[model samples]
Target: MLLGRDNMKFSNKIVVAVIVGLMSFSGVVVAEDINTEAIGNAIGNITSEIETAKEIQSEPLDKVRINWETIPGAVSYRLVIQNGESTSKDAEVKHFNRIPNNGYELDTANMFKAKDYYWRVCPLDYDGNVMGPYSAPKPLIGEEVNPKAPLATTEFEKMAYSPLYPVFSWIPVDGSGGYEIRVSRENKFSPGRYEVVREMTTKNNVYYEEGGYTWPGHYMWQVRSQNKVGEPNTEWSEPKYFDVEQHVRVAALGDSITHGGGVCNVPPGYAMYSWEYYSQVPIKNLGCSGDSVQVMAQRFDRDVMPFSPGMLIIMGGVNNFRAGEDGWDTIAAMEQILAECQYHNVIPVFVTATPINPGLMSKVPTIEPAAWNWKEQQQLLNQWIKNQPYHVDVTPALTDANGNLKAELTTDGLHPDHLGKKIIGETISNYLLTTFPSYNLTEK
Candidate 1:
């Protein structure tokens, strides 16, 4: 007894032809064997709506999205989040691929103001075969009110202070992907006064860590949250204040290659050692291994731009070169970093990477001629910096007479050893003296 031509069971026996259709016109794959598993699949068909989206909080840019159960036979989903109130309708139509990733997220930019939003889904097969159906029009059902940044927040009324460092607390908000912690010297300022500092992505409230001391002055700070969606910037919370005395603030920003991975088992990295030897100013390290010029561009505002330092010593490009990051275009990213510093009135100091020891090449296989190749990229990056205003080159001080890693000078193949760091430090100190000779040297 045949159920049907495609094996669809009607009564139990009578023969008939049934077409299991694919929603897309390109769907013409005839699998005579049939997908037995799809029959009575609990995952259900495409048109059937899964659980309604919950916790749909409003954020900047009408960044509306939904969380739903996976549909049967679905390899990915078509998500359409839209607002229909104003002429500038915000819409995010993306197809999220299914992967073993823990979860998924989307950035919904280009949103409208004050309007109703409509959303739906199209479950698709591996070939994006829509599961025969489309969801009924589901209105995101929103108020047409213009969205604003999260209301400013602070942890407490009475603030505590530390001479070495100070910490600020802030109440947490959900729609926020990150925060901007602001600190002010006095009282009233501008609409967005205080230094704008961004926090990392999180699930809870944010607390900012103060790395070192201050001028023992009364300081007030605040927090502003942000989503990766529309306004790449964040709005700050109300202000909080604290007091401290005096400490010259200084820090370093570089790539992992500068974090002193090379034979560095001690603190006060070679950079700090250099700072101590050259000037009396203390310094901190801000290097991340394998970081690229592009990533640096994205983080420039967050990393270099915020500090508002008198001087910023930047050392990197080894990872970029080693990663085969295109040399011609890498400077574009570097230029952005420079622009940000210039905008903030911060001095940009360009330092070449300490020379690479050939023997160091044996340790890292991914890097070919690892040490030698890295040196060339460092030099090329410096050459690009030569024409920039306010740019100070620290190359002559770190490299050997023959442009090779000094065999007797360096302790390790890759990084500066104690003795090597000392020499490097002296060189930079001398340059600083010759260039800015006015910097007060506190030490004898």
Candidate 2:
């Protein structure tokens, strides 16, 4: 009996040992698996989150774009942006504050001319435990150019300018041809709902259309460019206003200088300066960079005549400096532009050519000589112009003694800066206001 009892005890001891061994093995496997409680602890460890947004873009005076990285398993995203003062985190521009995102406008000098941004994603499980805002998103950049409202390039053809239907025809914006025009008389116009007057196949030409009215007397117009993506870019042209019959129409015509080669900083072309922006009269720029008198003469009928402008401001003969056509030849072309205007009842104002840096004068590979020098032939032309009925000389007022372009006026040895534009425009404006008492062609 004692032996039977001993055997039973031995068997019980073996069974107990086997059970403990199994339990130890099960404990290791359980440690490798994730549990709900473990995930909760991980979520509690996070100290920061998207507040203002990971990436942002703002137009200097108008709009803002906000984007963010996604949460690991986020079903949706909450992108909040705030304006005011930042306190701690990227939350400065967050919606967390009472300041609404829509309340602020971008300060041009403070932020980037064009802003680019990026973000990542967060994955969320069925349970709200956020795994991660996991991946780096592609980078995006804000467009740097904020095209100011476009001005009309032409005058009221009928001469009866109306607040109700101010007729305007402007030089068509390239790539923007065949586009939809958005007119905002008083309020900001919807760019998307604009009427499609132009189409995909349109090219360079004048665009004349009846724009919609926003207020009783207020009116504004803009044309947007289109492509395969549909409405592509909306850098607005200068905005035009129609008030009274007293409005003036002026067209600045010539080679590249009128086109703004030096001032613009774009594609080696000129920049638009205050001349067109500040002049009270409607200014039409008929300047094409690197054009010759021959080319100018060819396009003259189309460029100078149609505006029915009160005045024609011509600033060239520089590109004609070394042009195969020199002296009387160059003068003859200038005369042609003037005679056409005079015949059309348009006033002709002559601008002495702006000085050229050595580099630009050397543009033609085969030629090299003077920079900014208008030869005796050119001088004869200028003298002859002064003698004409409609021709007026507007250079001595702006140029230094010796006829050299004022050094202070240029940005690069060639292009004029804001200061230069001021000088040039003031000279021209004063001339118009003084000489041609009826001159009323620019923005006032």
Off by over 4 Å in 2: 1-248, 261-274, 322-324, 359-378, 391-394, 397-403, 438-444
Off by over 4 Å in 1: 1-250, 257-278, 364-376, 400-402, 409-412, 439-444
| Residues 1-444, model 1: lDDT tens digits | 645645554431221123233422236655464454564343344324343322233335444324444343343556554454232224543334432111122334554432355555566543445554645545553322222333322222221112123334343343566665555655344433444333333333433343433333556665556676634354554455554533324445665444432232222221222333333444434444456777766766555434445776676665676555565567777887778778877677766655566664454454455533555576677788776654555556556766756655443345554455555545555555577667653322
Measured by TM-score, the strongest candidate is 2
The worst-scoring run of ten residues by lDDT in candidate 1 lies at: 155-164
RMSD of 1: 21.4
lDDT value for candidate 1? Answer: 0.48
lDDT of each: 0.48, 0.46
Error of 2 at 343 (Å): 3.0
lDDT of 1 at 86: 31
Scored by lDDT, the top model is: 1
